[model samples]
Target: MTRKIFKQFFLALVALLSVTFALTTLATADTSNLAAENVDITFGTTVDADLPAGSLLKLNQPAGAIYPLHNSTGKLLSRGIAGDASTAPSLTTDQIKLDVQSGNVYYQVLPDCWLQSDSTVTLLDSTGQAPTDPVALTLKFVDANGKEIQDAKTFDAQFSTTTDATTLATLETELLAIRPAVTGYNLVSADQAEHVITYHYAKPTISTGSTTVATQPSDPVTTTTPIPAKTEPVAVKGTAIYATKKIGLYTSPNFSKATRKIWYQKKQRQNRPQFVVIGYAKSRSGQLRYKIRDINHHSLTNNRRGYITANATYVTSLYYHQNPKKIQVISGHGLNAYQAVTLHGRKLHHYRKGATLEVKAVKTHGLTTRLVLSNGHYITANKTMVIKR
Candidate 1:
């Protein structure tokens, strides 16, 4: 019996030792999986990585390829590699660009992909020199009528005769950044040219005039006809007119009352109240009134038909009535070309500032005129937007 007990105890001891050995092997395997392998990386020696762990970098990539650029904190930043347009780096290229830094900065090509001393990264100086032909830039502040309100400010140091797109765009951005504030005058337009920038401001206008209504009268009211006082016509049919002072728009030729009115507001740079003469209506006192249709877009009284004063002092012809032999876009912002005379549909094209376009024809649409272009597009005939060249 003692011999049997001894054998059982010996078997139990062997089983425990076997279990402990298996547990020790599993613990050693877990430790090996958790540790990171040491890698020797050299960035400048070669373009391609030789190690099995290092990422494979391609050589002779085109310029402007999107790369996985990283910041100091390993944050990814997308940037294009530098090169010429014809030979620029393609989008799929694995090339990267590094800006010269002051201290030790890390440039990560990809996740866990790095070049320490094995790859050669070339850096180029990108700073451009200033142009030698610098010119004086004049900023003219004018009122709504193109009359100067303040002395012209000249910045001789801020401008150069650089024709590059980046230089011109930077110059314009700097010009607007330093604009002086003028109290009691709201800026209307900033017309920019090669050397001159004209800023139009509208002064606060306080005038004494008859109050006008917004909506038109449903029915025309008859009034007693007075004896004739004046007989000569102020303007004939199809004449374009603009208000010099506040004016009322009457439903009829007679001065019964103004169903609607136009205020003397020229705050907008290109937009002003203008109309085309349809016919004439003689008031009771025989005062000639211009029967008109509103053509100023975005105006509350746009497209309305009424009779207005024909006094040359109050209403006058637009700058030009006929199509110019040649026209150029003068507005700082480019003008839109339309498919039709009326600006009702989507714009057909946009002509940038300083573009010269040939005029094909001019037609009267809603009293205002539209210039048909040589390219079969329509643009506004307003003098403020385009200049006769």
Candidate 2:
């Protein structure tokens, strides 16, 4: 069983491990082109937990022909001849027929698709704290094209402590959990039940009336890239602005980017993460990003390293509020922005009230509504009637 990828979804019943399985480790089974058999696949958990004794798993809708591995008697091993330790997988006759297509021969051994039922999920912030609302909410299987396959499957029973069944009902025979909260990340795989599959190709020897000749192995016409590479969370460090101690920082100059955390405070020596920036990155439209770092870093292999992108983490200053941009006209009178965030500092611009302008991002300080103008200027958003920047 290879490591399955688990998108930061909260699931206490099963853990998705995106473990990269080494293909070189498995010894190839002998191939017989004339009589290759297909192993049937089914699904069930080996864990002897408190699940209902006979609850079944099914998909919300039929997207593809998916069968989970069974867990009744024991794990069905790959099939082979004597001295061949591989156990044969159980498959329906229909799948076996499909396996023997016009250009390929199927094998009797199927990949492992065992489902364990002991893990639970908890959505954690980068700081290891749960969000005010549940963060990791959606979980499902997807095709390699990044489209969801089906709705969450259900069981015959409504699972509550008092419901007829206490076991989980899953759909698609797929084994991947997804969290859509994270931006710019997607879970894409055509893999079935999240199992790594291997196929044995066999070329038959045609015995003509008076000739004996060998043919090349059949081409794999229907094979597909079934698994996505693991994506580890990254740690970023940012420099603080304003020598006074801390200022807002962001992953990028984009106002919509998230604010990075200040992991440590030298003066306090506590784990309190303050939203602050360390330094600035390149700016565009007068918007700049603050460099930031992850407080705790995960150890990685494959010569892996972590990075914060213009889209991932950032500093949150008054100039870099976490809001999307909007263009509007300064519509009211006596409206303006203050440099000190209070109603007391000099204005960054002298735009007349009711003037049309583009508001890049917004931040509210006390009674002031600061706005970043399209011409690289600042003003209060109070009078703006977005005219589309």
In terms of TM-score, which candidate is strongest?
A: 1
Best by lDDT: 1
lDDT of 2 by residue, 172-244 (tens): 1112211111112222332332222112122335688899755544442222112222452211222111111
Please give the lDDT score at residue 147 for candidate 1: 89
User: Which residue segments of model 1 deviate by more than 4 Å?
Assistant: 1-241, 244-246, 250-262, 266-269, 276-279, 293-297, 302-306, 316-320, 330-333, 338-348, 353-369, 372-378
Model 2: worst 10 consecutive residues (lDDT sum): 89-98
For residues 44-150, write the lDDT of model 1, one tens digit per residue.
11111111111122323333322234443334454322322343111111222111111122323333322221123221112222234545556687877888877
Worst 10-residue lDDT window for candidate 1 reads 34-43
lDDT score for residue 133 of model 1: 56
Candidates in order: C-alpha RMSD to true structure: 30.7, 25.7
Positional deviation of 355 in candidate 2, in angstroms?
A: 1.9
**Total colliding residue pairs, candidate 1:** 16
